[model samples]
Target chain A: MSENTTASTSPGVPVEDPTPFGWLTTADHKRTGRLFIISSLAFLIMGVVLDLLVRLDLTSATKFVSLDADSFAQSFALSRETLVLLFLIPAFLGLAMYLVPLQIGASNLAFPRAATASFWIWKISAVVLIGAYLGNGGPYGGWANGVDLHLLALSGLVIALLLGAVTVATTVMTLRSPGLYMDKTPPFTWSALVTASMLVVSLPVLLGQIAILYIDHRYGRVFLLGNYGIWERIDWIHRTPQLFIYVVPVLGVAAEIVLAAAKRRVFEPLAMYFTIGLVGLFGFGAWTNFAITGEGADIIDGLEGVVLVALYAGALIATAGLLGLLGLAVIQNRKLPKISTSLLAAFAAGKLVLTGALVGLVGAAADWLEIAGRGNDGNPQLRMTTWVTGQQSVLIYGAGLLGLLAAIHWWAPKIWGRQLNELLGLLNFLVIGAGALLAFVGPALSGLLTEQPDFVYADPNATSLYSNWVDDTGAEGLSALGVAGTALLLAGAALLILNLFISICLKKGTEATEDPWSAQSPEWLLPSPPPIGETDELPMLTSGTPLLDAQEENEEANT
Target chain B: MSDITPTLASGRPQRPRTQLVATGFASAVCAMMMAGALGFYMARRHASGPHPGSDWLDGLAVPNPQFDYALLTLVASLVTAHWALWASRRRDTAHAWTAIATTIVLGLGFINMVMYSMNRMGLEIGSGEYQNLAFATTGLALAIVVLGLLYIGLMGLRSLGGSVGQRGSTSLGAAVFFWDFAALVWAVTWYTVYVVK
Candidate 1:
């Protein structure tokens, strides 16, 4: 047993880790969620490590590292892939699994055993995916069994994620307390519903693409797609519009954190839901195909193209709307809200999401203009350039990871019944925020200085990701700037891993009081880290802010 | 805080619709996957510039008619699935058993015919774009059908234990929904790849 096992939770109760067998087989949503959270964070370290390698490799134009271009290709592909698939997406999914039911006044997900199965499959498949990379078989590897394993493992991961999404979505749709209809559920729960729905629709498209990639690769017939630019085709999951799905949760999560910190009721909760849903609506990136649409296809030249461009712009507006509403609530607080790391992280998350959206908007508009035959040139050629990487970093690193940090801080007491070291959380946020900006701005500026394609071919002449592009400045400093940004991101990720270790294992921080933040959601009604909240009786919720309503009732009773 | 804790637990649980909702959501996922795959198929076919015929599977023998038979068998399974749902709801235990067994056989028959069609086509994997897609699209459809079969089989076993005798069993409805979804997708695929060539 470790020190965390003997940690204090409630006033007299002790928090203990479940027995090994119990943890593995348990259908308890919270336990399953814990498994997801810990594993994904572990994956986060690997992703950042690979990124550091890529950074070092890219520090110069003519190969900074001794390894071949193929090795760096694998590094580039795995770095982005692991961050999104292995870390951010699963981490947020775990958050939903752990908190959605509790927020909606339920005990477990709609299908508890299936949820357990999903998590295990995800964990095993994640191992296989990483193992595939380790065994010389990721994106640009030799035609080996490891490559097939990567495809099959990816197929399994998609299935697991879809199953998990169904569980969360079903729970939200069916298991909410009787009086709490969809509209009346809390912001986080609503966001989970929207997020799960988006995943259900968008992820299947990826599965569809993967099916072709897998079958082709497995059979050794790359006739349809001979080159191992497989990552280029499927990497749309990390692209502009689709990548926003991961950030949609940030908008919803920020609402919950702001409400609790402000101690003020959201005057327009429905508006909040609409904006959240709108962001999710555009995040349905199943329609955008990088290979076809990015090449100035007919889809971009017509009315469909205009509508799609408008939708990308719409996503940015929704992010702005969400930030404005949240800002007002905070500014209007009766007294100054407690200045905690969680609150600060929430603010920073908003700014990052907005920044990411702005970058995405620029990319979309430029592509639209060029395809519509009204552009001077594809200036700053966002596709296949570091410009796209900049947008991805700001979104995935800034919004997704930072928002997750904020949520963990806000809900740590409720999750583990102990507070994280607040000082460490603040440092984590600042370091990561600075890293996100540098990662975005450096590459973005570099894109303007000269043409540095993010995905470089090993042969260098076998294939070109961008068909129409002329060298702008042809300079050398762009690579170094990108390297600097990558270094900062790696540093920030390392600090996060250490902070989590100390908080979860070593510190055994102060026990969390019930209603730690005067939270309005149903989760706050339970004892901090209660075993299965659905078992607890709760007053019938008439609105999103159930706790606030209950407080008024209590005041009336006392009077 | 102590006084409010009591009222917090006062809310009562409602009838859960999880089973049906989950099945419905799963069905939606299957539908989207098929749609996306078919879209990919069409895009690839068009990209390859082989518009010699309407159906992309132009090289295969038309008189073989194996895909036609496979699609028919899957549609037939949907009817039997609906019958089982109806019987289970009416508490006709014997008809429910018969209907479920018939549905299972049809589901198995559909899978057999699909594999048999693949065999009859004699298309080896890794051959080219057409052959690879032929296996993948059909294989994915077969997997969805197998998933429905498992759900139907599970619900059928529940009927023997009399839990499914309860009126409005969502499990039965869900199984039927999944089967119906499987058949619907197969029909669309049948038209796209097997018909109109």
Candidate 2:
């Protein structure tokens, strides 16, 4: 295909200006995508700083940062809120917005205006939530239960999440290249679609909870004050179903990276898609398991015990099946060259997800035994303490963040026309991986040792079973480990940033080629940082790996 | 240079259908929100016994005639909105414009009737949890209907200006879909809050 013929300007006539004003108003997917990523990164840095502060507080029994009990609670709450809501989700969203159109050969997002609106709304919500922290020490009700309590800042954050979800979902459903059918779409794009769908289903319930609470806070008590069941239900909806939401996209990211690294098509593309679909179905069904016992027993008593067990089993099985298929695909391919950073990170993410699933299964079994009256009553608290926190760390931070890092490394060239330093990429992975293990494991072990649940222990310095555990049983050592892990994680994050800055701003690297990784997707067919509004440059795809087909055609012609 | 028209332009034929699907999805989201609000209201209602506001439940207990009239108005507005969308698709510009104008008026009337009814009942949102639920459910439905009216009104203006016609009916169709969804939600809200004891 002739370059000139394929490189047409974006629809509705291209704007001429290239100033800041132009960028602010530009509906171009490339620019919008970058804005989402950069803003999310800024949020990520803030979240990491807050996380380090929380770890610092946990290092010793006494107040570490001159913070009171409420202030300490606020710190951890804000860190989680920032990381989960403002950082990780939006970072993936930015990647999807920027890359999905290019991957599918679409010139722009389906609703560019809506995409712009969504990003700004999210940014504003983050600011509002952070401002709430500055104003009144923020909503101390923990990130999962925060919005359900009806704080102004938390309400704004939920609304922002809702808008963002709608915008991303609409884009995936409506925008694709002319010939790119649903099954033929790239794995990352499919993951995005799944993530968006989950957001649509789950976020609204949270929004509703927030709305009701907001009305109560502003006007009167619509919901009963301190109703544990209501809070549990709301938290269950936001937290449990969301585990799959975070990991599904990462699975997609890892799949793409593994395929690229292995230099082979997915061994069973149809099975892979089927597994993804099953994962989504099971993800939705598993929300009941989170709230089925403990505080939620009263509210969810009507639900059959067998159904809850089935849901948990199904979610775990589906997740395992997905990971197994991906691993098999990678193992069967023999075209592997040197292992790239993307591949290593992808491999690590898969391991983390599998670990999370296995941990979840064990937790489920423990809960089953407790319900069956065969285990100690304290098992529920143990499940809440170590089991829940460990699973979240393994799934969200370990798997989700690693998957995103892989995407960042894999697509850096296509995103900014520059390559990340491979050594630094690997270093970032190792340091963060170690940090993640220590930070998560320390808490999990400490949680098991403690008699009380995680949330009940507001002040670690207080004279309680938790504090005794901290004082006696290696908990202090574990806290120190957590602090060390956090430091290393921060260092890893800084190195990743440094590498990008060196490559892009310092111009320390050579420009990337059109197909730096010999990738099979259509996106690799375009130049690194593919021309804006020129997505038509790619040839129409007849298969999932269009670039591979094109390479084969060229090879045949040359021979 | 080879003469190749970009697929982006060629893909225009599929845009309307995709947009329609998006509109449908958005409507589903709205329905979900309505369900969530309703669920919250029911939970609150059941969690606690009758408060001071339960006294006013007498109005809903007897099937007030005013509520029946308001529901009729809402149903009429939905019909006219769909009529306008159907007319627009057939390029019946005059009929479309008239039907859309009537729909907007009916929507405004419904909002007014809700406010009037709330006033007549002397129900303060702060009176009790039940009153609060009533206010929130009705207020949410009202806000959605107002949005629907604004959208349909804009389409009506566009039709009159000849900016929209048979070729540009997707926007009108989407607006109609939202209006119909709002009406359905209001029906559920009304029954749950006013009729269901």
Candidate 3:
């Protein structure tokens, strides 16, 4: 409960007495960090399991479960939506929300009790969401009024979000330790603060929309229906504001890694600011693209599409700016040694493989789009073909999957104080990467096959997802590759989970360690097992590495 | 830079005086938040087409009187936050506890009002878009206020008279201006463009 404002610690400062029922009553950031990681991984497992079910249903070309076509459709889409909304986003925030402020010198979150309460709210909401599956007509039906269950789920979601947002906002606004001002704050912290602001502003609007959705479901609320053009409003929420929630946080993490790894500050402050602004603005524009392209009297299908395309172009520019920063860092820091270990496998190998797969698929899609000559007018067949074959499998499964694996490996030591076996980790990365790359090729081949005349004997009643792909030989090959990827992915995922289990089982004597990455930072300078209160001494910052600076100072004093 | 060194020998840093100021500002904000929520609830009750026999020809019906109960709750929350700040500033242990006890009462008032408003609205998410905006934003704003009050209350437990509640109140007060202004602008524009138009 004591205030610890200084960044430095006094030597051998006494650790504060643990609070009564400390572990149970504790709201300490580090404990919260561990909980966040575990909870997110749990959600990830659930999402992956659902994904496996989806893939299995597609692979077998029959309803594995005794559900109608509509039910199947509803289940699949909802599963995809939930995977992102219910699982990934929440889980990612679990760590980021807890860790960012602490890393940036915040004493505690702005509102600690709210932080604890939000966790409960989120858990309850998750339960209600799962419970919605058992009710009247499942949680949602595609393009229909059966949205009440979802609305109910959202009520819980809004409560949770409000709690999470308030806690995070206050932490950012009030809890920063003395000397860490707006500018002096770490880069990661800056990105987090920006993201937190976005969340505070944007989440309420989303909650408002969810409220409307509840009405539409429960009481003939025609907000999104033909009457109010509610769908357009909902789409508005989706395109711009929604993108920031995901992108900004990822940018924050990337910025931290880039700056620390490159040993350089951000290239230009204005560029970072401009990039955040553009993303926020263009994020809104992208929603118009979600509008139905064909003529429904209410649809505003005119220049909105053109505007969306142009906005997407802006997104590319921001991405380029980030890449430019990365490139500049490379050129400037040729002397800094590249550190490698089994942990780097996911970052290095997974990325390389995922990149190669993206290239191949993109090339195939470009070729198909040109051949079909439906360049501006979106050809549904061509679009669906490309989606099922490549982007869906690659981006969703490859980049997302591998990136998470890498993050887990990188953060494990710091969080758990245990090292992953380097050989096993590298093997897991390779298996996952190979599986993803092979999976990408399957789609392009399906597209090529679709163009050929000799394609027949594919099942007629085999649903849009299956029938679309079966028509293309390239798609068929892609599906085959998908089968392999699925096997490999499952094996890899299982192996990773098994490794976690093994680590848990094999605990060593308690000791804390800092700078698990062997990197240079103030955090790393602390004693291996630092005191809980964080000692009252500050390292004199000569170089970026504080431990080295301290060692040098000691040597000079001795001389 | 000279202020970096602590004069207090107790090892606890001094509380920045602005914390008391922030408590004042946050209390006012919370009052507005409660008032807005009450207004929204009333507007909806009025809009639900005149309570049974209580009709007037001009069609300007006042909303649910139950909203007063909610407003009272919000006021209670504000007072608690204010007292926490006041007690901490004066180093008054007894009043700080009293303030905390009052905040809990206010928190209960808040919950009661939310439930009552939900019941009266009958789940149309507050009658219309403007009402909906009013209720949702007010709800979030109230939640923030409640948390702020609770934080101040908690700050009391850590202080045996060394100075725990210092730094960042003025900044927070500054932040509330932007936050409140943004909400007002967003709501006003939304009403003008979509609801009223």
Clashes of each: 7, 0, 23
For model 3, residues A423-504, the per-residue Cα lDDT tens digits are 5667778887777666555554554445311111122223443443334434344555655776687677777767666654
Docking class of 2: acceptable
Alpha-carbon runs more than 4 Å astray in model 3 = A1-24, A59-71, A134-137, A141-149, A181-184, A221-244, A251-302, A335-400, A435-476, A508-512, A527-559, B1-197
DockQ of all predictions against the true structure, Cα-based: 0.55, 0.39, 0.08
Candidate 1 structure quality by residue, lDDT tens digits, A145-262 = 8888888888888889889889999999988766788888889889888989998988887787778778887786544444364776677777778888877888778889888888
Give the CAPRI class of candidate 1: medium
True contacts kept of 3: 0.01
Residue A119 of candidate 2: its Cα lDDT? 78
Cα RMSD for predicted model 2: 4.4
Model 2, A535-558: lDDT tens digits are 434345445677666667778999
Superior candidate under DockQ, 2 versus 3: 2
Q: Rank the candidates by DockQ, best first.
A: 1, 2, 3
- Model 3 earns a TM-score of 0.65
User: Of the native A-B interface contacts, what share survives in model 1?
Assistant: 0.57
Best by TM-score, which number? Answer: 1
In model 2, which regions exceed 4 Å deviation?
A: A1-11, A14-16, A59-66, A140-150, A221-238, A285-309, A369-380, A457-472, A534-538, A553-559, B1-14, B50-63
TM-score of chain B of 3: 0.46
